[model samples]
Target: MLTPEFSITQDDDFIFICIKIAAIRFSAANLEMLVDENLFIFHLSPYYLRLRFTQHLVDDERSNAEFKSQDETIRIRIPKATKGEFFDDLDLPTKLLARKGDILGADAVKAPSKSNAGPLIQEIDTPGENGNLEQAGEDFNWEISQTPMPPSDATRLLTSKYGFDDNYSSVIGVSIANGNDINELDDPEKSNAEDRVQERLRKENLKFDPEYYVSEYMTAKYGNEDDIQINGIKSLLKFTPPLVKKFLKWYKQADDKEAVMSVEFTEVEQQQMQKNLPKKTYLVDDVKKLYITMLSLLFAYMYEQVENEGVHNTESAWTIGKLAPQLSFLDQQVITESAASELSVIKAIVLTGIRRSLSYPLHRNFDLSIKVWNYVYYTLRGGKRLVIQALLDLHEVFRFHDVYYVYNTVLISDLCAWFIIAGNENIIRSLAIELKKELDQVTKKDIDFDCVCGIDESSGEVSWENMNIEEMEILSEQEYLQQSGRPA
Candidate 1:
């Protein structure tokens, strides 16, 4: 065997390495030789080598023991090239021969005849391919496949492998593997399970009823629809059915409450009411409360008309003017006398009815609305003294400015107006004075009165140009004050 040797040296100034391979031999008589005694040189630069060996193959008897034995030698050389360009400068033959010899030296040489480079060959025999396979198979024990396990057994295997107990279904078993607890796995016995299950469920941060989670998700994402139905039986199994039943029951009860007062009022009545009353200027809560109170009173009035009077006058829709009088009478009868204890109860029921009407899903007739408003106004106004005294008694309850303002303004205004119309100037003046004092305190802070004065300079219509005596007086005073130089 002829051993291959290579020598390499670098010139520091040139940044190139000189590589040389020597003693390459070939039997010219027996082996085909492409080239002989060739000096392959490469020019290398700082960045790139002149020669690069992309692929190589070597045929050495020692490297391929199954091939015919032969002595072979290969040599390669490179001179005066930078390290980066050293390989680039080398010729192809030199690059190929050098890399091939390097590979042969690294690997144990085997005979060419025994090399695995030729045709495909099988190393193992199967019973179908060789009759001796049966003899070989006889050494190994084989038996009939065991009968398939029952679903229960399969479930047990899955649970055991995934660390789940009997309470956990297969889906929950998978979830447990993903860091969820078996207790979190939806189970039918969530409520009936031992306290330990509940505790475990709490620890696992699992909902007792999965449907609740789904419903919450649906409401948040899709909003409330008329009817919602869940799909998929397996998904359904993740929730306790009885818990769902309870939720459905509650939903139905709520639906019933909403249905009770959802009466629609006529458009004509709405138009008429809108024409009669000033445009509504109230806060959202106040508007809602007003609408609800009207609806409830309308409902009560309708009931009274139908049951007591045996009348079916839907045309006589409630109006603010109409209901106010009735409400005032009811208030006088209920609140002014020694039966004051019943006043709180009446107020509570009225407030509750108002709330229910507001939350009710449908609209009510405008006439009915007007009637209810009238009733509420009259009731408060008729029992003004009693109502004010009651407010004083429960001052804490009436502390909110919004509630107090509406109650005093609308309710008390109705009473004063009615009294004034009835030619009771004394009562009107007394109420007016009291209201004025309250108004003064309320308006103590500087206010933007432009809106109230209806002055629109932007329209180019100077209505104030023809000043009245009062206005001219004020203007003259202002001019005088400015000229007085007293810092007025």
Candidate 2:
């Protein structure tokens, strides 16, 4: 008897077939008393056999009635070999499990439990061949290799992962080592160079003459006062009651006993006698002399300031205006012009004197004195109308000629022209034109007026054209006598 849960199979070598038997039927123990009971079974038709197999395996059922209907059977029983191969060919988990257990296990176990259980083989279908799979693996590796490394942890990871000691030193050790010499690297020579430069600057700043600088600054801003004191004639000459009394005391001590006792001596004399003699005379003389000296000094000082201090144009003009009053007073005292005819010549002489005096070391303090003298001289000599008026004061004076000579002699003509261009163009142009004409006329003329005068021989006048024998003889004798008596 076969249990329901168990399957039985049989093979027929004649048909080369394998079959499963679900249940086997057998007759019960003997109907008649016999030596042994014999089992009797009915023979199964081929169709019924097939039907039974279909019911049990293909239809997934085991029934005797279904087994009889082989003609109605829609299912076919697949061979074990075919089923095993189908499962092994699948890539699904169930197929893989069947192949691993049924095929490989069967080989290891050496089992023949199922007939026709040959080696389980499979044909697997894939989108690509094995070559494509290898290529894909290579591509994946390349992609990973090409990927950019993260910056944040690259340094740390490079040394830690790759055994790169240089990277490790750069990342960590560099920072620690750099701290000691960072300042030196920032500005290596700064401290020493700064000290040297600062020391030089300090010495330079201290080199200037502070007092002289201050005095110049003050004078340029406020103008000079020494001129006022020196040239203040009216102030000095004014007689106060105290001064008169002092003068009287001075007179009394002058050893004028008779004059002091005599009633005939006027009040002036009495007052003079009452004054302190030495002190009054000294003060009077000192004040006069001091004022003159101071005036000269101031002129020289102003001149120096203009020339050396680079004063020009408007500044020069302003300086001139400030100095003019003192200069006028000095000019008036030095220059003595009484007649109109003498005016031009006296002016020339006076200007020359002023220029000469200012050039001396004693009067060198008068700034721009030389420049001013030169400007006035050439401008006037150019025959400039305005200059003539400016110098002559309507009538040519000794002062005008003096000024002209000084200017013409001392000034460079080009410099004078530049100054004239600024403020005196009309006069300068006219003068230049007139001077040019005069020069042209003088240059073109060949006749000598002095020679013409000498040629007019009459009325006891000697003739230059033909000298008389007596005159020629006298002139020769005089020349010989003069030459023979010479110092040499």
lDDT of 2 by residue, 102-146 (tens): 322222212222333221101111112223222322222111011
TM-score per candidate, in order?
Answer: 0.16, 0.15
**Total backbone clashes of candidate 2, pairs 3 or more residues apart or in separate chains:** 36
CA lDDT, candidate 1, residue 238: 30
TM-score between candidate 1 and the true structure: 0.16
Identify the candidate with maximal lDDT.
1
User: What lDDT would each prediction earn against the true structure?
Assistant: 0.26, 0.25
Model 2, residue 87: distance off in Å is 99
lDDT by residue (1-488, candidate 1, tens digit) is: 22122222223222122232233323323422221122223322211112223222122231211111242222222232223333221221122333333323322222223232221111101101212222222322221111223556544443321111121223322333443211222332222212322333232222122223333333333443433233222222232222123323443455332111111223332222222222221112112122223323333433233222323232222221122221211121112223234433234234323222222212222222223333333223222232222222222121233222222223332222221112121221222222222222321111111111235678865331222222333444566558766454
Task: Give the residue spans of candidate 1 off by over 4 A.
Answer: 1-266, 280-296, 308-333, 337-343, 347-488
